[model samples]
Target chain A: MNPSLKLAWVVLLALELSFTQVWTVNVVLIVICLALMIWRRVAIKRLLWLTGVPLFFASALVWSLTLQGSASHHFLIVIFTRMFVYVYLGGLFTQTTDPLTLTRSLEQNAHLPAKFAYGFLAAFNLMPKIKAEVASIKAAALMRGQVLHVWSPQLYFKAILTAMHWSDQLSLAMVSHGFVEGAPRTHAAVIPLRHRDWWLTGGSLVLIQVGLFIGLP
Target chain B: MKAWHLRDIILVTILAIFMGVIFFVIGPVYTILSAALAPAGLQPLANEILLGIWVMAGPLAGFIIRIPGAATLGELLGAVVEMFLGGVWGASTLISGVVQGFGSELGFILTGYKRYNWLTLVISALTTTIVTFTWSLFKEGYASYHLGFLAMLFTVRFISVFLFGGVLTKLITNLLSRAHVVKNVR
Candidate 1:
């Protein structure tokens, strides 16, 4: 599936998930998402860790509600199932799609402007550099007899300064390379919107609606 | 609204990514706090308390860029980066970003995009509180709680949003101006 289409599907379903409280629908969606993740070979270890936090939280929520006698069993189930539905759906998108490909698809197919697309791509590509710069900033702070904790404004301030410097250099380089804002640009590869993308997206939408209708409280 | 220069776009993306790191750092804290509160049936309060920090990107980006949608874009991108960093929230992260960012943008919209002062920041915080709280009323099942509990949650969330989104953002922007890094928007 095209990355853009997958993102759209995930986002829309997440929105739908938020508005409704149907545990049966939630359960069905979770199972489907789990199946998709497994079929896609999303790393099981990472998926376990990723889903575990929500599982813990969901259990805690249900336990607390049970103890308080404030929520019904169905409500508890709804809350519990809702959390995993979100995680699995999200995990499916993140684990399956490459960020670079997503960006390219957004630019090529989603009408995302070249400026925002390339801008995001540039910064997205800079995660490692930003990490290194943050570490060096902390080290430099230690050398200067100033301890920069994670929540310290000085750490972010100094780090952002370096980031601003890099942004300046980066934009300069792009402009020098003839990267014009709002200009038509060619792509090395095309991310076509296949018929299957539409079929999957539409099918999921209809299925979720049907599930919602059937599970109406 | 001025057309976004390539520099502006890059700057927002980088700063948002940086904010994402901060959000990631806060994730564990939120989990610990939520876990601690779970026994008391107050797990949701943990989100109320820490939500302000999560919203910092919207106001911070709005203040720096002084553009119409900068806050929304910054926040949305911040959520993207967080998800990229393996946040546990999944697809909800992006939706949360949209809600939060729109809330922050409302403050700037109310000001007609002219002011970038304490008032603007405070209003942004207030609007974010109202907007996000409204979202919670539906999404987080706040409607099920007692009115008093809901009121208490709202108050805590307001304070959290004010301190982090308003005051902390001011401090960062202040530092940037003092260092002659970003062109002073004020």
Candidate 2:
């Protein structure tokens, strides 16, 4: 199967699994993806970084338990399981779908304005650049004898400032490129929802509705 | 008018992912820290403060974008990212995002969507703070907390909003406005 088609199925299955709250869906997906990564000879380090999400959720659960009253064991299990599933599925979507295809699909299918869609796309593409800029800023501060720690409110403030600066530059670049509101657009690539796409989407929605009606408390 | 470009789409996707990671990591940490470290009998107050912070995101987004649905969409995007990154709140994050976004949207709407002044920001803060905290009171079972605790929480939240969400967001937007980028886009 084409990776895109498989992606559609994965998305549908994820949506269905979300409704039922059967967290095994996430576990299976993660395992399969891991297996595939190994098969494809993908880097272990990159895969490990992706697993950071689960660690994050675990920390959150521990924090929540400490701060809030002890939740039922069952509830904790459900929450953690769902978190794994949700994050992994989301990660899979990003990993599988190219940003351009995703945005093009949204614009073509949803009738979104070309400008807004592009603006949104621009924001996504800027993420790496933003990260690089933030790293440079932190390094510069460190060279000046400032320690940048996540716990420090000053660090947060600096991040906000960096984001704002980047956004300002991004908007200017967009305008210079003639990205006007309500503009007509011509795409270099066309993203059509094939028969398999419709089937996957429909199947997922149906399964979710059924699961909600039957399984939800 | 030029159409949507491949680069723009890529940017938004990356931004969403970045925001997803940040919100996912920070949101739960913030919630837990506030709930844990807040003085005993101050949970309600903490809830209020958190809600106030949550509400501020919308007005801040709106102030920066000045576009219809900017507040709601931006807040929603943030929430969605948080959820995608597997926050402790699960799907409820989406619900909170919508309500909080609406609260901020009400403030912008009340200003006839024309002004992004300090008064508008204050109103936005109040609107989001009230609605969000009210929701939190129910969601977190804050009804068990004492009245005094609730009052303290509200006060702390008011201060937090004024300082963090209100003042800080406005300052950032102002800087952006002066950067010639906002002027050019407008």
Candidate 3:
């Protein structure tokens, strides 16, 4: 499926699940997403950690509900399954879709501006450099007898100061490379929204509604 | 807003990407905190406590760029970065980004997008607290909590938002300016 369609499907279902607490639908969604993730060869360890941690927390939530008796059993179930639903739904997207493809699809198919899209792509490519810079900043701070924790402002200030410098140089390079603002350009990789993606998205959405109408829960 | 220079766009993306890394680092802390709070039925507090930090990019970007949609763009891009970095929230991160960014943007809009000061940052934090809290009321089922609990959550959220989004944003911006690092952007 195209990234845009996949994103739309997941986001729509998340919004739907938020408003309604249908555990049956949640179960179906979870099973399908889990299957996809497994088939896609998502690392078993990461999958287990993702779902297992949430499972532990969900059980705690149910236990708290039982002790408090504030909400009913059904609501507890809804909350419990909703956690898995969100995690799996999110995992399906992040695991299945490549970030570069997603950005290209968003820009070409979803009308995202090229400036923002290419800007993101540039920064995304620079992530490794930025990460190294962050480490060096911490090392430099330590050398200066200063301990910069993750939440330290000095750490961010030093890192962002470097970022400001990189951005200026990067933007200048992009412009000198004949990149014009707001001009349409040809794509080296055309991320087209195929008909199958729409069919799958529409078909699943309709199937879910039909099942819901027939009282799947 | 004037036409966005390619430099401005790159600057904002870099800044947002940086904040996204911070958010990613903090993600595990939030997860552990929320799981710990779950047993006490206080998981919501985890979000409230960290929301200010989460919304930091919006106001900080707005202050630096000083454009019409810079706050929203910065926040939305930050969420995008978070997702690409394998954030657990996945697609829903985009939704939260839109809501949080719009909330932050509202503050600057109220100031006519001219005054980038403490007052604007405070207003941005206030709006972010209220907006995200309201979103939780519907999305996270915060409406089910008791009135006193809700009030307490709101207060904590506001304080957190003010401290990180408002106060910390100002501090960082000041530090950047003092070092003469971001003089070219403005």
Candidate topping lDDT: 1
Q: Looking at model 2, what is the TM-score of chain A? A: 0.61
Tens-place lDDT digits, model 2, residues A1-217 = 2334544555555445544444344455557656755665655665665577556544454344435444555445555565565455555544555546756777776677776667676776665665665577669789999976433344444555555556667777877878766667788887776787668667755765664466443
lDDT of 3: 0.82
Tens digits of lDDT, candidate 3, B1-186: 576777888888888887876666787788888888877877777778888888889998888888789999999989878877766777668888988999999999999987767888888988888888888776655666667778988999999989888888888888877887544232
Give every collision pair in model 3: none
The RMSD of every model to the true structure, in order and in angstroms, is: 1.8, 7.2, 2.5
Chain B TM, every candidate? 0.95, 0.77, 0.94
**Under CAPRI classification, how is model 3 graded?**
medium
Q: Write the per-residue lDDT of candidate 3 for residues A141-217, one digit (tens) a residue.
A: 89989998756788778767777789899988998999888998899999878889899999999988776667655
lDDT of 2 by residue, B126-151 (tens): 87778766764544433434566566
lDDT of 3 at B142: 63
User: Clashes in model 1: which pairs?
Assistant: none
Task: Give the whole-model CA lDDT for all candidates, comma-separated.
Answer: 0.85, 0.58, 0.82
Least accurate 10 contiguous residues by lDDT in model 1 chain B:
B137-146
In terms of TM-score, which candidate is stronger, 1 or 2? 1
Where model 3 places Cα greater than 4 Å from the true spot, the runs are A60-69, A212-217, B180-186
For candidate 2, the per-residue lDDT at B173 reads 61
